[model samples]
Target: MPIEVKNELGKIQVMNEVIATLAGSAALECYGLVGMASRNQFKDGIAELLGRENLRRGVEVRHEKDRTEIDLYIIVSYGTKISVVAQNVQAKVKYVMNEVIGLQVNTVNIFVQGVRVA
Candidate 1:
């Protein structure tokens, strides 16, 4: 009897994990960032238990050959200016993604998903 190994194929490299992680971390680092929470926390927790690599549900990475796009959906702390927070997030995320990941980001889209009370 002989043991044989099969090679896997057709893996679509949609986005770079490092860049995605950096993006998520950067977004969270912004001032007045409450946290990344799912609309349904229970479902999100289950997804994590199932070994989903991208734990931050509201963040997304759209990859291209030469550039990457970032989308961040966030909940701001109550009484914080949404505009200021969003601007900070955009600047920080863009800077980190470009300097650290060495990838050109076409855009950083910030979506104000919700506001959390203190």
Candidate 2:
């Protein structure tokens, strides 16, 4: 589904993939965040880190009513505070989506897929 934004001129529709990529990129910028992780569960129970172009694989975007919801699957650096890092990612994702794309994000949910020493 597309997110619709109405203005005096007309209406703008943002694709769900665009929102997911934006959110994924924003999440990757936060401190202690290693990289975005694919949400697909493997038999080994490990998720591969995703590169920039494939960021959407790790991000899920949905629109409910007038609000946009984002879910991020990420890998964080080992020994970092999970809650603090997650919070920062949430704030940054929300801000970037709102400021850059003119999309107001109602929630940014972070899922810690795994932690790496690096």
Candidate 3:
């Protein structure tokens, strides 16, 4: 479902992909984050890393009446504090969605797919 907003001019619809992109971008900017991870899980239990163009593959957005919830799958650098990285991602995603996209984020959930040495 798209997010609908009405202004003096008319109604605007924000697609899910837009939200996903914003969330993914925000998450990637965090210090410990390596990259976004594709949600598709392999039989060998590995999640593929997604490039910039494929960011939406790592983010899931759900729209409610007044807010949106986001789930982000990411990989972090080895030896970084996982909790701190997750919190940073959550805060950044929430800020971008609210400030840039003008959407209220109800939740930003982070899933750590893997840790890379470099």
Candidate 3: give the clashing pairs. Answer: none
lDDT on C-alpha atoms for all candidate structures = 0.66, 0.89, 0.88
* Ranking of predictions according to lDDT: 2, 3, 1
**Candidate 1: worst 10 consecutive residues by lDDT?**
44-53
Per-model TM-score on C-alpha atoms: 0.68, 0.94, 0.92
| Clash pairs, model 2 backbone | none
Please give the lDDT score at residue 96 for candidate 3. Answer: 86
**Tens digit of lDDT per residue, candidate 1, span 1-118?**
1112223653322245556566778888888877554423444333111113444566777755555677877778889999999999999999986676445678998877667776
**lDDT tens digits, residue span 37-108, model 3:** 998764378778889999999999887677678999999999999999999999988888878867778998
Candidate 1 wrongly placed segments (more than 4 Å): 1-15, 39-55
Encode model 2's per-residue lDDT on 1-118: one tens digit a residue: 8888787889999899988888888888899999999988644887798888899999999877777789899999999999999999999998999898788888888899999898
Q: Kindly give the number of clashing pairs for every candidate.
A: 0, 0, 0
Which candidate has the top score in lDDT?
Answer: 2
Q: Report the C-alpha displacement of residue 43, candidate 2, in angstroms.
A: 4.5
Clashes of 3: 0
User: Which ten residues in a row are the worst by lDDT in model 3?
Assistant: 40-49
* Native-referenced Cα lDDT, model 3: 0.88
